[model samples]
Target: MLKGKPKYKAIRILEGCGFHAQMGLEVLEQRSLINTSPNGYLDMHDHIEEMGRNIACRLHPNEPNKRRRLCDKEEIEEVLVNDLGTKATRIMNLKNPSIHPATIIEKLRKMKALELLSVYDADRVSQNWVFDEDVQYFPDTLRSLHWTGYPASSLPKTFQANDLVNLEMTRSCISQLWEDGDRKVE
Candidate 1:
């Protein structure tokens, strides 16, 4: 689904979900399904790449909630604020996603199939974008989460993090990862 993304990064994300990336990548290479670029990124033919991305979306172009990837800004915002997500939405990439602080967790709980979530804080200044309510739950289905300016002090313990692999929070307010008596130490 990631068209021009670095291969290593995709492998790392997949590895978190118990996928044998190295083995699978090698097989793809052997079958000429993909190749390694000079920069070590995945290289594929144009038709092949186009076909791969379309297989999941060709059946539901009119339905944003049923698409495998959500990139439309308006639709992305709608899902965040309205909780109109479905299992088909596995990847969501958005810039400056704005969800009311109080409703953040409630909105997240509805995205049960989210595997990769990348939220860019391009507009909002890097500050404490936290909420009044302490978070009680975070999506356990995430394999990769890249959120700039993460607001919470500690990760919700209720977040199982069973499939979590890559967690990137730039200039976040997090002083601790989880509250294990270490939160207030510093």
Candidate 2:
């Protein structure tokens, strides 16, 4: 058993390790751990199941067999809006190996308190996926959006480039940024 005072506000569960989800939850609930490192063993799967709604996960890369564990839109909404309540912020789906593009879009659309969102897929090619809703649903608090393989032909009518500090959308199908004649080039 590990001993010593818990000084870290965040923890990382190394891949293939046998860290029990309940134990991690106990430490988080009792010790006030507020964050979890990205691309590690402790992912959204653990978060949703272990009562980690208030704790912000920096990234949520898909598991090797992600299709079986993928949370539907309702579950994602429940975790972010109902469970996390006002504490939900950053949501990262970067490097997800098998998640459908629409699923990622739906997740983003439902999350309102997001400050950083990463839906980058390093392995996939552009699929020209269209979001059912407009991007305007994205919170004004959002500052970073890193979505690789974005398939839309243009950003939603509500997107304002001024609000974003870091924007990376490689392999996107955007032919134009906005419909209005005013285009801001930096």
How does candidate 1 fare on TM-score? 0.71
Off by over 4 Å in 1: 1-6, 26-55, 98-105, 134-137, 179-186
User: What overall lDDT, based on C-alpha atoms, would model 1 receive against the true structure?
Assistant: 0.70
Residue 77 lDDT, candidate 1, scale 0-100: 74
Model 1 over residues 1-186: C-alpha lDDT tens digits? 444558888789878767898899889999998888888787889888767757756777777777878766677777667667777778877766665433544566667888887776655535655554444456778888876666667666556676777888787667777767333211
Candidates' C-alpha lDDT: 0.70, 0.46
Q: Write the per-residue lDDT of candidate 2 for residues 1-186, one digit (tens) a residue.
A: 011212131122211123454566567646544333343222234444444432222133322111212223443444433333232433444454365665555445544555555555656656766666553345555555667776676665555555565566788666676545546433
TM-score of 2: 0.47
> C-alpha displacement of 89 in model 2, angstroms?
2.0
C-alpha TM-scores of all predictions: 0.71, 0.47
